[model samples]
Target: MKRKATAVWKGAGKTGKGTLSTQSGVLKDSNYGFSSRFEDGEGTNPEELVGAAHAGCFSMKLAFVLQENDFEAEEINTESQVILEDGAIKEVFLITKVKVAGLENDKFTEMVNDAKDNCPISKLLDAKINLEAELL
Candidate 1:
């Protein structure tokens, strides 16, 4: 399956404004500009979107990994931090909190590591990946 999003930009780099649209329409003609990406602004940016996608994908992968190990999680919250350095993405840090019943620490850690290494998004990223998992 393939998903697509389109971005349209006009004018010069610093002064140009852009709109990003996704196939699902969640970002239909959403605003993105230099201020939005480089400075604090109300518009959306690519790094923010990447963080959201990474977090969502990691959470889902963690859930599946837990279930596969016979340890169903009650809640899984993941936060992905993408760091950009020298105009390129440098690292992706995943901080996850999981609430599961009847799962030991060692086993849970193993599963979390497996999910971090095997998740599709994680595999796709060339940046360094860091994960922190906790059971609550």
Candidate 2:
């Protein structure tokens, strides 16, 4: 499987602006720039996009893992915090609250850990992965 996104930037680094377009069209021509990325600006940024992807990816992976264990998640809410420090992504913190019936807390924690460790984005990121999971 393959996916692609395009970025177009013009002018100087600090003052320049850019637009990001994804093949899926979900993020077509989204605005991004130095202000939007490093400061509060009316646009999206790379870290925000990465956080969304990580959250979505982790959720889906957990669903599949639960299915494999003969269980199903009633709901899985995951929030990813991509910590950027020293101009690099130092860590990804995955905070999740799951609602699954008839699943032991220990088993659920195991599955959550597995999903956090094995999710595609998680595997791709060369940074520390921290998780806070609640089996509600």
lDDT (C-alpha, whole model) for all candidates: 0.91, 0.95
Instruction: TM-score each candidate.
Output: 0.95, 0.98
Q: How many steric clashes between backbone atoms does each model show?
A: 0, 0
Which stretches in model 2 have alpha-carbon errors above 4 Å? none
Clashing pairs in model 2?
Answer: none
Most accurate candidate by lDDT: 2
lDDT of 1 by residue, 1-136 (tens): 9999999999999999999999999999999999999899879999889889989988898899988877788899999998988999889999999999999999989998999998898888889999988988
Q: How well is each residue in 3-61 modelled by candidate 2, as lDDT tens digits?
A: 99999999999999999999999998999999899999989999999999999999999
Cα displacement (Å) at residue 55, model 2: 0.5
